[model samples]
Target: MFPLERQQKIMDLLKLKKVLKISELTEELNISVDTLRRDLNTLTKQEKIEKIYGGVKLVESKFAESSMDERMVSHLEEKERIALKCTEFIQDGDCIYLDSGSTTYQIAKYIKHFKNLTVVTNSIPVVNELMNSSVELVIIGGKIRLNEQSVVAYDYIFNFDQLNILKAFLCASGITVEKGISDYNLEEAITRKKIIDMSKEIYVAADSTKFGKDVTVSIASLDKIDVLVTDANLNKNMIQKFRKTNTKLIIAEGP
Candidate 1:
């Protein structure tokens, strides 16, 4: 099999078994030890798997709940590209909601040029990024999540209902055709649901790595999303699958 095919098979096996011994992988793929090692190295470099003493394991749940700092560093360039693309949907005087996530924080960074904009968010990092800017900021009130640097309060849904958001840029822990959009935290999921309900247009900001995975809670269906802004690294097969669902997929060019 080709290298990409072999790597994909390795990821498929890791998804099923979580962790696989190198010897077992060699047996399963019918490849030599050296070939298996190279495959493991490639997967590890891609951050799709973690190398252990004798084998490799899928970077799963723990990655979903990773700290904001951890996430900020993982896909910095992709997040920046997606953030820049998100700006295209924002008008000068638009009232928008920025969901709490590293990618959304990047959006906040890029929006500093918007002279007249009302920004609503629960993300502390986002607030910090836009605080010194000309944008009008409305912070959501809720119990603080220290690691994520965001807020989560179900009562805030009532506040969301009071406002009309022109557009909303949201992030997800994982997104799949079957499960739609999902995240690891229940409270954040509830908040995102409300944001979707209030917004006129919804744009999901996620990297290609987030595709084909499902996390703890569902936020919305694929149909609910107006656009999906992701990095250009997404495969053609995945893009075709997303197109079949009628979700407008925008692959942001990387810097």
Candidate 2:
């Protein structure tokens, strides 16, 4: 197979089942260990996969550690759908906290012209998105974490803890019943949990792919979420499981 195709296959396998050993790749992909090694090397260079002792693992770091540009490509159509779904929970004259994520940022796009709305966010890009709007904007001030492209240390914790929030949109690395809402960064998780705790209603903005994934830290339990807006591609059983919770699940693609 072509190199790009092979790399894509490797990523797919890793994403589907986390880490993959060399022998496993050989058995499944019908390729030699050497070819697999080359594939791993190539993907590693591309920052898609990280090479482990005897296998390869998908890159799990959301911020790539300490890089300044914490940019990523999300499932765009799904994010837009979720954004639309979010509007259902929002009423006029509501004060909301928007967490930093590609999906949450999508929500910002939909809220630009919204009246009687207040937005408090840590993302610089998010602030830029809503700055021109008539909606009241409150930019959380803190130590700017370039990697996540957010403010997490000071402004979000001390400054925001004083305010009463009506609603919050939380983005997660994984939204599992087992682990609750988890994120790659500790500070980010803390910020999200704090926001949820402060808000009268908490809504999780995530894509279906985020379900069942695992992260290092837990922000809050599934019971803490009042609403979840996600893509329609979530597994039916899993979606039903989430539906059984106190949280209301809203599919973005609609009926």
| TM-score leader | 1
lDDT of 2 by residue, 103-217 (tens): 8888888886677898888887789888888888887767788656788846534666677789898888788876678877888887787788779989999889789877777
- The top-ranked prediction according to lDDT is 1
Q: What is the Cα-based TM-score of model 2?
A: 0.72
In model 2, pairs of residues that clash are 141-155, 142-155
- The residue-by-residue lDDT of candidate 1 on 34-104, one tens digit each, is 98889888988899997654677777554457667556756678888999999998989999999999898
TM-score of each: 0.76, 0.72
Clashes of each: 0, 2
Model 2 scores what on Cα lDDT? 0.78
